[model samples]
Target: MVHLSRMCTLVALLVALAGCASAPEPQGNSEILNLQAEAEYAYQLALLDQAETLYLEILRSIPNYAPAWFRLGNIYSRTGRLDAAILAFERCVELEPENQKALYNMALVRLKQSHQIISLARRQNGVDPQVQRQIDGLYQALLRLQQHTPTDSN
Candidate 1:
């Protein structure tokens, strides 16, 4: 159920952003859309680094483009670059606070951070300080997000 909701939210956000772009768009930069399509294809093919580069190129052309930021974060998360994933997700959220997909993705990444610490604790007697600090930070962000965001099933 949660996965379905996230997928719906992601699709809605993509459609919404594509329609109501503030500065970016298929019209202003037709090539940007083409690049996005190429990036997505690379992503589907599991060519994460290539997709990241393509998304970064799109961002360079349109800094405020939320979809690029969100997609970049997705690639980062899949590639296990947690810090960069969070930053990219944060950028997307900054551009679109109502982006439920980004919000949900942030929560997933934070959970992944904690899972790393849990795995570390199981392997050794203690967790890494850096991982602990990152988990703490993500916890705080989740707390703040809970206040502003509805504690609904989504």
Candidate 2:
């Protein structure tokens, strides 16, 4: 026969496992899933404005959702809203540090902003030293990102 202490331990383990097995699904999981599907569909259709609104709605409910952040960044980048794009991508990276796609998009947005600044400076006669320094910094950042990013052969 088993010792009393060992029997108690076995019973406790069984009880814990039973509780876990009976745990109910989280509330609103299906709602969130539906919203995510709608957002992805809008994004695929290139309905950027609609997608952006949907993403914002999802984020209000789940602020830490990295995919919504990434999609929002893409919409902002395509709409020429570089500043907003950077912030959205940065948030996505904060939530999922290993997300290479968000990092790459951030670099692209920064490069576009740099090009715009340079163009404006040229049109105004000459580049300001401070502006030139900022552009150089952006270039250095891009080089660093490229060096650290892994290439996908496929």
Candidate 3:
């Protein structure tokens, strides 16, 4: 049953990402920027595997490149690799704690996976409740992040 459900999810995910557009580019070091163009192009062209590989290679050399991590997360999300997406987004947030987009994406991925986690947990052979609670925390954080900041009233 789980396998069938996963395959159906995979098909739906693929259709949704068939023409998915690339996310915003992050400004990185000049050396990193030099390598980013090809990866970005691959992403824009929806060559997800190629884009992922390129992004991972960049991270290997510059693990602190938050943009690469964010982009990799986006790619993973589009391709239905939710766990990988969460990891990439988490890395992006860790490197750039104030990046709203990374925060949002991390929350989004966690939200999507939370449904699965909760449902599976309720099915008698479920996962630990702590996982569900952690996702709830992330969701709350995302909501706090999306709150509007007061602008100058002058």
- Using TM-score, give the best candidate's number: 2
Off by over 4 Å in 3: 1-34, 121-154
Residue-level lDDT tens digits of model 1 in 1-154: 4356446655764675477556556563556667878988998897988998998997887787777788888888887898888998899888877777787888878777766765555455346888667656666665565467542121
Question: What TM-score, computed on C-alpha atoms, does each candidate reach?
Answer: 0.61, 0.67, 0.57
Please give, for residues 11-95, the per-residue lDDT of candidate 2 as tens digits: 5534533455467645555566677679889988988898898899988877877778888998998899999999999998887
Sort by TM-score, best first. 2, 1, 3
Scanning candidate 3 in windows of ten residues, the lowest lDDT window is 145-154
TM-score of 2: 0.67
Better of 2 and 3 by TM-score: 2
Candidate 2, overall lDDT? Answer: 0.73
Query: Candidates sorted by lDDT, descending order?
Result: 1, 2, 3
lDDT-wise, the better of 1 and 3 is: 1
In candidate 1, clashing pairs total 0
Tell me the tens digit of each residue's lDDT in model 3 across 10-123: 355334334334743334433455566789899889898999888888878766777778889899887889999888889877876766676677777766676566455445
Backbone N/Cα/C clashes per model: 0, 0, 1
